[model samples]
Target: MTSDTPARRRARVFSRRRSAPSRARRRLGAAVRMIAALALAGGVYTAFTPGAFAEDNVQLSAAAQEGKALFDNSCISCHGRDGQGVEERGPSLIGVGSASVEFQVSTGRMPMTRQEAQAEQKTPQFDETQTKQLAQYIQELGGGPELPEGELVEDLKTNPDALARGGELFRINCTSCHGFGGGGGALSSGKFAPSLHDATQEQIYAAMLTGPQNMPVFGDNQLTPDEKREIITYITVQLQDDRDPGGLFNLGRYGPSTEGMAIFLVGIVLLVFTSLWIAGKS
Candidate 1:
């Protein structure tokens, strides 16, 4: 019979340790199995989820297809293939959606005429149908903010309450950048807040949703749908009609700065002119 001495016990322990995998090896094996199990679970979930399948199997509509064609011909230069966008040339349009495309194309801001500090509004290259098709293509490529259906305040012109509410909303939300009159104000850098005078309801809504250029996005979370409609009503009904005092005397409607300049410069010039006339008559 072998006595269980410390030497014999040490030998047995070493043998067991040798027979078993090293701690590092055991941990590596466990990690590999865990990863494989997770991968299998993910695969099953992806296969079973209807939403995942729908997103993966989506096919472009006719309008989207036509828009893709137009994009290939016209927008591909800077935006790149599949609208991935080229570095430094243009931003990726994948997630921008239809609202952004409509606002840019309809307002004739995209397909920019030479890269400047900002893309100013010009005559649109694409007409309404083409613009819609383009917007649809972008909307399908990557889902994003979309304009709600039905009227965006068609009756706002007649609704005095709506106009009043809208004016108040506009004053609170828009007065800083757009100025009190919505004639638009100069921003830092070359970018400027655009005049909202001629902007249509759709355009205004789109701008609010997308936040073109320096404009901050007024998402539904910040401003509800009805509030947007009211603001649109105010802009269309009140601001558009709020004309400047006519003639060359009005100068640019930069609010107080221009008013102050008119008071100082024009007042001094009138005084000088009246003095000369009085002296000559005497």
Candidate 2:
């Protein structure tokens, strides 16, 4: 009887040990399931948040959609499906703001006559509202530089100090292509940077916003709208205000080359005339 009892006890102990592993495995599975559920909830929360997945659904107005369709049909052949132009055709419109679109389209320089050295103003294809709609569409497609919602004209007097600030901004921003004095310069190919001498405040603002022709677009991100206006103020008020001591016929403000030519031609003509008059008198 004692031997039988000892054997039975040992067998019972073995069975209990074997069952422990099964219990542990069940617990582990439950834990894994709990962890997976928590992870799924976290992922759901992140996805629904603003700017997380919302950007994908940014809807355009009806006008913008129409404009986009028009752009895709008419402009995209050369400008590219996404407004990133092909080499030597159009430039990337990624950041070019509505102001640029408005200027180019409204002025009739867009839907270009042909690929040329520069696009000159002609009869516009779209009316004012359509132009604005196109601008809005482009603005929405790729979030970039935008014209301020309210009035475009800013209070020039409030930031009178910005003129000096603008001077610095101009030197850094405008001087490269427009030159230090806003005289403008030549670009690659036959394209030339148009002189700012004749540009009005709105025109300059529009140009900075639009980046017409071979000029690369400078978005508000690249140069803020306020900074743009300040630049316009500096160029128009300060630079344009300062008059040349020399009379009309500023000779393109190109300095010595033009002056030298004028001196040689005019001086030679005067000398020859003076000599002829003296000989006639004798």
Find the candidate with the highest TM-score and give its number. Answer: 1
Model 2: lDDT equals 0.73
Best model number under lDDT:
1
Tens-digit lDDT string for candidate 2 (29-60): 99999999999999989876532221345688
Q: Which regions of candidate 1 deviate over 4 angstroms?
A: 1-20, 37-57, 245-250, 254-265, 268-282
Predictions: Cα RMSD each? 4.2, 8.9
lDDT of each: 0.86, 0.73
RMSD of candidate 2 to true structure, Å: 8.9
lDDT for position 94 in model 2: 62
Residue 279 shift from truth in candidate 2, angstroms = 4.6
What TM-score would each prediction reach against the true structure? Answer: 0.81, 0.58
The 10-residue segment of model 1 with minimum total lDDT is 49-58
